[model samples]
Target: MYAGTAKFPVRKGKNYLLRIVNAAVYNHLFFMVASHNLTVVAVDTSYTKPYITDILVLSSGQIADVLLTANQAKAKYYMAAKVYTTHSEANIDNTTTTAILSYVGSKSSTTPILPEYNDTATVTNFREASDVAILQAYHFHIDDVYTTDFPSNPPIEYNYNGDVDKTLWVPISGTRVKVNEYNATVQVVFEGTNIFQADKPSNAYSRL
Candidate 1:
């Protein structure tokens, strides 16, 4: 329940490199700074082509390196991390972990507009494997937020309608994980899906 921490000072026109690590035990974070945009420089120990984005989402064990330039007006801003929910259960942390980004010689502080704690629909969609970022990356890129090199696509567009295929809709109780080698090149779909299976479509439906 540590809602906020000490103030971090900055000066106008200076740039800072930050290592943002998500080491939480059971939470994911959506981090942002009030009135500031982050230029993402790296992820999980690998240097990525710099990408600029406003809100960043990171799961436990993930690390993001971002460049922050103090180019805004000389004032104080809130840099905050709030929980991003997983599972479609009725649970969440409505509190935020915040720290002040105070510009030297500034007098006022403005809190950032934090994102909603957990939009179950979006989270469920992400879990459902239908998010645009995830679906689009099925061909040559990433899952959501992380970038990956290419692997051939499913070779054909396959459909899975859970409404008709009850047996194929969910994973059995015990979760079996597949391990990959270090730096292995493979694409994994964790929603119990294998769209490449050429069996009856009724046996191909999967859901999270």
Candidate 2:
């Protein structure tokens, strides 16, 4: 959702491919359209096995391409977006940003009701994804073993089938960068998503 306003017009009986990006500074996003179902076709730059879902779960740096059909009777519907806050104990954003999915000739005041702030089931169903599309970020496949005492797993045993609770969520003990060695194979997967990096020279992180 845009900061100031969110509204876009579309013609009826047309299929629209939405290039949705979760560019949140530090939060995942759950996006949906009122009275419409999204056919998710792609993610990032790769095409996914087409699946239909009312809600889309996106990481901060992830991108999804969904096909939307304006099949509903010509009327203004609400396109809602809210932060997916199951990663933590409590929600930080109370405002669910909304936009109007206006049919070129219809008007209405009804808005789409979004999911709860801490809806984990939807997020889990989306996360257990199966990748399609013969595309990868890198061409070369160099498998190397990680060498260090750095924690490679989450600090807790996370069960996606549970409700939102602070005690259920994993807690990061602290940032643990690997030790710098002269000649060692590095196999690390960095999740720098949902974070904003400034142009300052300092190596400080806004979020750990």
lDDT of 1 at 72: 95
Q: Give the lDDT of residue 107 in candidate 1.
A: 88
Candidate of highest lDDT: 2
Model 2 lDDT-worst window of ten? 193-202
Which stretches of candidate 1 lie above 4 Å from their native place?
1-4, 86-90, 120-208
TM-scores of the models, in the given order? 0.56, 0.58
Tens digits of per-residue lDDT, candidate 2, 119-162, equal: 88877877654332222212332122222356556555433333
User: How many angstroms is residue 194 displaced in model 1 relative to the true structure, after the best TM-score fit?
Assistant: 46
